[model samples]
Target: MSAGFSMHIFFTRFPLESQFGGAEVQTLSLMEGLKERGHHVAFLGSCPVLLEKCFALSVPYFDLNIGPPPVTKWHAISFLWRQFLMRKKLINAINEQPVTRNEQRVIFMLSLSEKLLLTTWAAQNKIPVFWIEHDSIGRWLRWNPWLPKLRRLSRLATTVAVSDMSKRMYLDLGWNPENTVVIPNGIDLRKFYKRQKILRSTTFHIGCVARLSPEKGVDILIKAVKNIPNIHLTIVGTGRDENCIRKLLEQSTLETHSNDEGQVYHLSPTTSVTILPSVPDIVSFYHSLDLFILPSRDHDPCPLAPIEAMACGIPTIMTDACGTAQYVENGKEAIVVPAGNTEVLHEAIKQTTLRTYEAASVQNTFSFERMIDRYELLFAHSAKL
Candidate 1:
């Protein structure tokens, strides 16, 4: 359970500095877990929120001088060309802390470009790098000339998929099957458990926590609940579709309010919905929900929200495309519905209201400890420690 010797871990794209979501939370959990076990953990990216967090935790952070990825596909060629200099800046940053003979250096990347760009640097230094890909790389890069070389370089490090679905996706894209692994994301069960004396609110409360993108299928959930009487819908997230969702809400309901906490709608005193762009903490929110739904319409690599909710013992309804669907048994830990089927989803919402679905101690398979153990074993073997 211990590294015996300190392993220096530099992780990239610390969320909130650039963006935030499930992968960011999982990365943070991994850093905290490794730090607790006496490993030397440091952040390798920066943003305002990340800086504040790093300072508060006394965790050192270094910015990767690699500029942001292309905002448009036409710019991708230029971005790839600039990675040559970016790689040099990163290597210089990594070398600032001299490595001892006994010290093992690890780079944990959660982004495709970071993995591809750092491969050569890691191979030259003989460091073990891991890229736990949480999203699929867009197909626009498939035809790019730089990708062939990058893919070859990518072979130098391990590619960790967050779920079997992601593993299959990677294999389909010609990733080396031998070097890839599937590690399901997990949460702290102790922190996400249900409250004592479970009680439902006067109105049926259904919840979802995900980025408000079209692929997330939040609109489907809203549509599903639109006709349901005396129910409350709560969504917690922020993304490109925030304005679109707000407009949809304004058209779908009677009363609406927006603030720093996000938006609120009152269909009536007994029927309402609330949307919070973000929350500092979500344990209480999960505990308060009678049902949790993940209505993703696309290949969701691995979502931590429903896992946290399932850990808290909330009834869960998820679409088939969600990566975590493989972990939970249908009709047991959670109910699985086809993605984008508003009729079926709405019916599920109506039928599952006030009912409780147990996770059947899914923590045994997806606990943070279990996830940390798998990661440690991978590193131990890779580091030859």
Candidate 2:
């Protein structure tokens, strides 16, 4: 079906400007694609960062004035009160839109609370809703006791999982398999593609682009590459664990310095490590790397980093915990290893350094065009129902 429908996307977490993760990228790409197809896209959320991005994209949006969810009990009560007020605003915003008989109006939500609130409203109003699931099950929605009761209302909406593994996970969490569909995350080929291969450097450069969190296994990567000769690791992105990572690297350097008793040190450290904040020019970052690794300790559902790196003609190493591992073959497009196993990760990096292979292309499976097409079809189908 062609895409000339009106889609209202509800995502109230980190804004596209402040936190550009896989989910944020997907949302922006999807909205842009739908707009290109002559669809009207609107974002309904309270993230100032996202509002700025929406303004840049020229997409109409409504600000719910909500921030991150609360932590304390008193704050939780205040948050729920704000949500109640936001729901009224949401309903008013939806009612204000001019109703067109020819165009389909649908709600697409990324956050669990927003999905529940909006989907319940949509069900009562006979509007279609699409819930995009980006992670594995056991998230806030599934764990909430109200989920079972909400399932009836959720029947009016469709659940979209970003990967097949995620789809199974949702089903295991009691989502109707028939209502859940697998649609892997996609990347814009224009942003990530193979450049002319550069001359090999004397030192092998390994890179990782992920948040410095425990689940991301950046610490494990640090341990794996410690004291290794002629290898450099560059980590891009920061999180709560940044301090811990810095301490770990400091300890490694201390150990290395103490171990150098009679040996002469070279100008460059045998194992070099650099931690950087997120950059806008990620394509250039991938190009500078000889190899990319995503050593996630959790089940990373359809991570975009590895695919982006592969699209840039860089060989990547991923853990089995990544859902994208199902799409890539070991020793081919990527090297798959056990998550959080520093020894295995270390060995994989060493082995990959000695091996030479052609750059793999993910255009067929993970291209943005393919992803948008699937979403268009789903949106069209949902509108019909």
Candidate 3:
């Protein structure tokens, strides 16, 4: 088993299948990188509209949905049950010996179902299974009934966590820290290149590219924008909270209020706030804005949007809870603020509007090429074993 050896990796979701936050981007980029290296790659899963839009022109991968229809959400009582059934299908695939690798090193993306199947098959066949954990264990262990199974899989497979925080949490939860690898998500520098000249905009635009979910703290940014004068906010991404955000903004504007402390909590209907639909061309959106902000309220493994914005030579303001905050230096590359603090977010946005900075200085450390090289090394090593 070596670098040139033919290996097949199974993805639970095609990188182009869903509009995922950071995990999907990283996984899809890795798949593309591996394909570029001439590895025989196959994707196995379904995708939603967001992913379809993002990767519409991407290379085609294998999709299992061509067979009989998969289990529906209406039939499954819990998320865990659906996951269990999906893995059962994959387990059958392995038992049937559909795909084969001479020096088998199986990699499983974020699918817990695939993780279990690979672990079980690996234990029986002496094949190595690598489990890529994209989210925090703390977040999943709370409601998921599969923690015990995850622990078992962790012991059998090489667990790859995207951030140090996520890896530490897994270790705290009694996972074998030795088998875990912390591979921080990297930005795709080629795609996210900064524009030579900033796009001319009528207003000082503060933009964010994130799922409109509560954890992302889009509302916090909205509240912060209320304090900044003459600043317009553009939020990208859609989620379950989209309706809630629309309602909140609509109601806030209708409330007649002056600039008192309560005014921050209450929105005057007269305020100018624009909510735009998600766009396929995020690069253009990042370039069109004067500044980028990440106002996440909860801990995230690592976010690629802030790093990508910085790569495009756009300065960013990210909250402390963002795992990628480690890459930013205050007053140099980006402005770091505490999560859920509207005042800090407001001041950060205000300061960015008044600053003149060079994006090249901050974009050196994050690049897609560098990330691909790291994965190539990891995959090579895995195949050798």
Q: What is the TM-score of each candidate against the true structure?
A: 0.91, 0.87, 0.82
Rank all candidate structures by their TM-score, best first, as comma-separated numbers.
1, 2, 3
Q: Residues 1-385, candidate 1, lDDT per residue (tens digit)? A: 3645678888776232255677667777888888888788888764544545766778888755477654346556677578787667777878896666766899887654566667777878788888778774455445555566656765787888988988887787777988899888878887887766565557788889998888899988888888777888889988889899878887877777676665678766566788887767798888778889999998898898888888877889999898899888888789999998999998888778455667864666678888877888888788762
lDDT of 3: 0.66
Clashes of each: 0, 0, 6
How would the candidate models be sorted by lDDT, starting from the highest?
A: 1, 2, 3
* Residue-level lDDT for 57 in candidate 1: 77
Model 2 lDDT, residue 169, Cα = 73
Winner by lDDT:
1
Candidate 2: where is the Cα deviation over 4 Å? 4-18, 66-84, 99-101, 136-142, 150-152, 255-268, 354-361
lDDT for 262 (candidate 1)? 59
Q: List clashing residue pairs in candidate 1.
A: none
Instruction: Quantify all predictions' global Cα lDDT against the true fold.
Output: 0.77, 0.73, 0.66
Residue range 239-334, candidate 3, lDDT tens digits: 779899877776667443333212222343323555555666888888877888889888777888888788777778888888777656777778
| Most accurate candidate by TM-score | 1
